[model samples]
Target: MYVGGGAGNVGGAAVTLASRAGARVVATARPEDAAEVRHLGAAEVLDYRSPDLGEQLRRAAPGGYHVHLDTSGRGLLADAVDLLAPGGRLVAMTGLGRGAAELPLGRLYTRDASIVGFALSNAATADLAEAAEGAVGALGDTPWRPRIADRLPLSRTAEAHRRMDAGGVRGRLVLTVGAADGR
Candidate 1:
């Protein structure tokens, strides 16, 4: 498995989940994110900004990846398709470039590859309930504890957004949406 954008909170969660699910995951990030990706349980890390993305990914997963989960969605679906073996699956969740893109549909069909857009809210109600329960249970596990970068008061929301937009903070940027005292 190959997980793209494996440095941020969501990406790190993907890497950890994939690893815990017993898949050998190779995670990609920027050059500065190598350590964080490794800490997230990536067997290997690739710098997406490098010119040798395909080469590095192939080297990391010699048999070709069976699945690709893209979190960045920065015009990576085409190259990701080329990196997969026949009958592989691409799960995309982000729209960094735009909400719509022109993918290589013919190539995907020819190779029996599949591109699935994930919608967390689209799951059946019962399934969602069960999954929610499972998630709540999983939270009790030590490894599932959310990594909180910092907690800021609501007054600093603008600064929090700025820091998040700048992509400088690690882990989750938590904001105290409401105060305990009646304000």
Candidate 2:
């Protein structure tokens, strides 16, 4: 599996999960996140921000990946499809541009590749709360661990959201939502 994103919450979690699932997982992120992604068990980490990102990813996944999960969007999607092997599957989870994408159909037809859209809100239809707990439990014995970028008091959640919105936040931005006052 090849996953693209690199420096956001969805990208990080997908890296860990894909690695744990025994894929020959190659992940893409910015230069600053390569080490953290390696620690997450990625076999190779490419710089997604590089001007030659498509070429870099192709090099890392020479045989091409059967599956590609994108937490970014279609600009990257266009590149990701170029890396697809015949019959490859690409799933995009970001509503980066209203969740609608414009792809080059000729290539998709030639490769016989399929692109699917996903929204995690769909998790609400299933027993996802339990499933999430189960997923976390399944990994307890493994080396997987999410890094916390910052911890702030509950009242500071506004600032946390602001920082996350402004971009460039890595790992997880944890809001300590329930600590007693004056602790």
Candidate 3:
């Protein structure tokens, strides 16, 4: 299960990659983003704002998800722990940001589940290049692709950053760097 429906490019990429890899991908997003998330390849898209989100997730994947990738880190650690299958793994791709989460250590130990934190920037250049090569190779047959929210000329780079900082952009905001005809 991947959390972050309206979480922009990273969330969209996770859904697409997981689905292309043949995982039964479930995702959470705002109600308005449900359709887009599904189009991105999520098998099920739950409303994160729903009061019964946990129950909905439980019903959707009764056995629980084998893996949960959290991007928002909006105090969902505990819930992720509860919704994991035995030996399931949760990976936080973003920082919790001065927030403290109370984990049920006993449950984690009993279920043999594990939680890990990761950042793509920590990977070696060679590893990143290999992964990029694999992604390019699979592009033809897979549904995975970057979701562009908007494209602006290089002159508007500052505007793009402003929008990003304001959290108004949905996906990626691309800055066209060269001529349209290809320099």
Per-model C-alpha lDDT, please? 0.77, 0.76, 0.77
lDDT by residue for model 3 (1-183), tens: 655553356677777778877887888887787888788788888878788888888998899878888775553677788888999998877754647777788887678899888988899999999988876776646555676899988878888889988975766888887785253
Which stretches of model 1 miss by more than 4 angstroms?
Answer: 96-99, 121-133, 139-145, 165-169, 177-182
Off by over 4 Å in 3: 179-183
Q: Which candidate tops lDDT?
A: 1
Residue-level lDDT tens digits of model 1 in 1-183: 888888766677778777877889898788787886787678998888878778888888776778998776563677778777788888877774475566888888887989888877679999989987876565444243455899988788899899989985767878775673224
- Candidate 2 RMSD computed on C-alpha atoms after optimal superposition onto the true structure: 2.7
Worst 10 residues of 1 by lDDT: 138-147
lDDT at residue 140 of model 3 (Cα atoms): 48
**C-alpha TM-scores of all predictions:** 0.78, 0.82, 0.82
lDDT of 1 at 112: 91
> Which residue window of length 10 is worst by lDDT in model 2?
174-183
User: Model 2's lDDT to the true fold?
Assistant: 0.76
